[model samples]
Target: MISRMLVKMIAVLWVGIAAGWLNPAVSYSEEASEKVLKLHSGLYYTIQKGDTLWDLSERFFDSPWVWPDLWQKNSQITNPHRLYPGEQIRLFSREETQTMVVESRPEPEVAVEPQEPPYYFYPPINSVGFIKERPVRPSGAIFKVKGNKAMISYGDLVYIRPIGRPTFTPGDRFTIYRVLEPLKDGEIKADVGIQHCILGLVEITEGHPKFAMGRIVQSRQTIELNDLLMPYEARSPKITLTQSKKRLEGKIIASEGHERIFGDQAVVFIDKGRQDGVRVGQSYYIYEQEKERLDSKKKEDLLLSPVDYGDILILHTEETTATALITRAEKTVRPGARIRSPF
Candidate 1:
């Protein structure tokens, strides 16, 4: 019992020392935007010019990486950089600050940069895509081309049969996609959802109710026969840095550039989406499973920890999948890589 109290006291003292490093500076900007703020038992220190969250977290937590928890605690500062120069951040006692600690460590000689390369040993959850359940089938596939061409490009004419019927208004628009590959599933079935590459968009100009005539209006990639079509829906979700409430495990199912590998700012698709509780603005860390490597000198295999690339932020979410931008990556990221929450 005495040891427990001693441990707790040491923890609080450590935190107090860390928090003491920050000195209050008056916030100067009046036009700057303010965010949601949390109430805690601490003195208020106004933000000032040249101040960065990294600096503040380091000052208060002794480790710059705790900024996310700091943001979460404050909640009001939606954008870390948009902190109003004049806004006040409440500083709290060490005991109170203990609630914000995501990780604890002994005192170190060097200060670490929170946003530096390989921000986490494991990627966060939002960046990892997950599919909790099988997704519904798309509208239909490109049955045949106007000239019966196997492949078609922008402005090409095409015909499509609604998944089961030819019952659509002639002027409806649809997004076209090429089925890429199937993802991991407990069981394999032809009807199960698979990763898809959006080929282009088509607008029905003329044709029968069951079979419609349409023209490829825009093509990010060449359109081809048998490419599936989905009802087009305009989307533009406001994405911000957000935290996940629950731990979710998922993988990168697809990528936008169709590149063999991805890196920072590269858009990728995850298997998890809205139904799985993933939302736009949430972030995740990307990592590849640790593998055993051959050591030439020892002539033996050495196991290495999972390689952390960096974080990915969910830009958009659908029913069973989400698209994310790899906001940071220390190494090349690729589909099948895993993602999870940092905390």
Candidate 2:
């Protein structure tokens, strides 16, 4: 009897070893297989001003046509054309896994439904022209005021009054402009009175052919009737096109104090506009005019050396002027600084 029991015990031990039930390494491997798996497979993007779904899709997915699907899946955006800046987008994996457990309870009957195979569709490989269906105007247009004497104080009620034949309706948005002095011979001269300050934004509360009323939501100073207002219109700012694009030059017409939120904001009246191929969201470097330096050893010796002051990010564009936000500043940027496209 003892011999027979020993033989049975040995057989049971061998079976456990062969099945990997008695080995810690085998047990660990199985445990690892059962655990959930994750992957770093997503992109995080921060939306910038004037960025469109089509532009973003073209940048990331290699196709702008796929923008509609991405917008539908990722955002609560009803209109694919409109996208706000400062919004965050995260793309994550969709795969998931579940584990099964056994118990003594009676099994319940379950029904299984057949699933159809997914259809595959490929987007076109060619680059498609991105044209606006309607010309994009400034958000607040008809209610803008125009004049050099508009006194804009902080916390003042601002409005955009339409002038001449009305091109905008009620509830339409427009942009406001502070009148700036003209550039002379590719040089911008800073005159205290000519430097226009952004008072605030206004919305059209009422509309008419000759004028419109708007409520001011923001202002750097108190707004008065003397301040000139330009209503936001969708039309591209006017520009004069030259035969040679390489010979074009950038001009700064006005300068404002540094913004607490945007760091610094500068008003540039470029010779180029929509007609000249100047588009919104274009970036330019602000180069301070080369200081005229004289050698101490020889008073007659003069040197023209260019200094880089900062960079400007274009925000709004008009036929005559473009508003830009300063991104990097080594020193205060003055009027007449040269702005060039980045290489």
Candidate 3:
């Protein structure tokens, strides 16, 4: 009977061991560890309401400007301007996972207004040039063109390299331009800054840390090899007509194309700008002074009253210079023409 009891006890112990193996209890620590591993492996995050790429970039990268980099990394974003809630954004990864899903929508094409506004609108005036006190230091340059072409135009792909080894990423835009000889004051013959003629607009499509590929989206002039690049700034098409509040006087230093004589609708550069209380949409009168007959008796010349011949509308302004469009010209306008407040 004792031998029977021993065999029965051994069988009971075997059954208990099998039960434990079949149904093991999971520890709290093991479950927590599994969750952490899953999070690290994917680094996926869900978009919440009122969340923006700018806010997210600042939260993760400590800078709001880093939003563009974040946007470029996520290939799923069709419109960088809008984001939908419940979309998953990958926080980190060189290779995006297949499970990642996002809303697919076609980006709307930006329509370029071919007609120039007669009075109140300026179509993409940023493509118009500006004057600086000094030559613009280039941020980058077009190094090569795809298909081994000599000239680049709209939709042409090219390679660009950043100067000073600064980092540039895809989706970044730059204004392509070329420098002409230094502009000079028509009266004093003083040297102004070099003229920057806008060639085109280029958007970086893909790139390395130092160099990248870009495509020309708009061409105002012929884009050539080694064309300089600078940060692109958006121009507003709507302009309001405003009367000048200050009695400011300045001279027309130059005109677009360096033309000596131009008329209505011509782009001209003046020596007065923001520092002198000049502003966009302000109107100024172009005039020339006549000599009086009192100077005929004496060898000395006597100045007569000023004669107004044209009207100019300010389009853009620099620190000490401005770009103006000739709104009306009774007589042909030329460099060295005097511009002053209408009052």
Candidate 4:
């Protein structure tokens, strides 16, 4: 009887140890099985004094309008335009996730206009030769600090000197013509054509003067300037028509690297250009597509909506594509993304 009891106790002890070992192995295997998913992630930074949504987006995502997508995902945010201190934002992955819970509130609805598709026009790249001209002196001259006062006031005939720069050889000759108006209160204001002009070029001259200066020769009948020697030139006018609305898309071709112009603002480059209807001042929206949950259920219940990551504005455009200053950014604008017209 004693031997049988001891055997039974030993057998029970062995069984307990085996069970403990198996349970731990199973638990560890289950825990390790959890998979990590990588998706595009964005962070919401709180607004502080002297902060605009434009700059904030650039700081966080490298684009400004990216706030819209963030706003779209976080329905808890009642107001999109204004943000309060200590607000929380949810970061979503490319994989589907739970829909954000927003309180039942009647939100104002706005209609989104359909944007026109972009048209591509390829202009032959050609090198042309033209004569360089020298600027003539105007009748009168004005003295003001460079940034303090308008360098060339509206309707003021000023001589532009190409100070021996590589682009402007010593003997290059160019002509200057007066535009629509004269300088006002020391500032020039005029609408020349596609570009708004304030001061008119009266002449182009070679060689830089010790002190850069401009003189107004022919002022409107009532216009008068201090008795200063001015520049002179014959006036010729030309009119150009502005292009209508158009759309274009392209990827980032290059970058100007990083710069801190105003606080943390930066500028970057793209691959689209004038051939694609991109001009000097055209605006575009930068976007990166993200996979999101879609409400597949055929019921009148809340569902997931397809969304994108971020957006930005274009500053300068070229023929194939143009370089854009990151006006607004949500997340970091990376290479190999799509930039399209917002409209």
**lDDT of each structure?**
0.61, 0.44, 0.71, 0.36
lDDT for residue 289 in candidate 1, whole number 0-100: 70
TM-score of 3: 0.63
Candidate 4: C-alpha lDDT: 0.36
In the range 193-305, model 3's lDDT, one tens digit per residue, is 77788887777888787688987765667888989998888776567777684678988888888887899888889999888999998999999998766646678767888
| lDDT tens readout by residue for model 1, 74-157 | 533546767766555555544544443423433466676566332222212222222324443778778888777766865577
Off by over 4 Å in 4: 1-247, 258-264, 291-309
The C-alpha local distance difference test score for the whole of candidate 3 amounts to 0.71
The sequence of per-residue lDDT tens digits that candidate 2 reaches over residues 1-343 is: 3344334334434543586432211222343223222223222344567778896665434467868766644423435677665443443222210011113224676687586433212111010011121233233332334333356432223444444344555555444444434224334332222234444445555665555665443343455564555454332221222122333358554444422222243344444455555665565666754444466676574546556667765544455455554657676655555777664
TM-score between candidate 2 and the true structure: 0.37
In order of lDDT, best first, we have 3, 1, 2, 4
lDDT of model 2, residue 317: 49
- Candidates 3 and 4 compared: the better one by lDDT is 3
Better of 2 and 4 by TM-score: 2
Candidate 1 vs candidate 3, lDDT winner: 3
Q: What is the lDDT of residue 188 in candidate 3?
A: 74
Winner of 2 and 4 under lDDT: 2
Lowest summed lDDT window (length 10), candidate 2: 122-131
Please provide the root mean square deviation of candidate 3 (C-alpha atoms, Å): 20.9
- Which candidate number would show the highest lDDT if scored against the true structure? 3
lDDT of 1: 0.61
| TM-score of every candidate | 0.48, 0.37, 0.63, 0.26
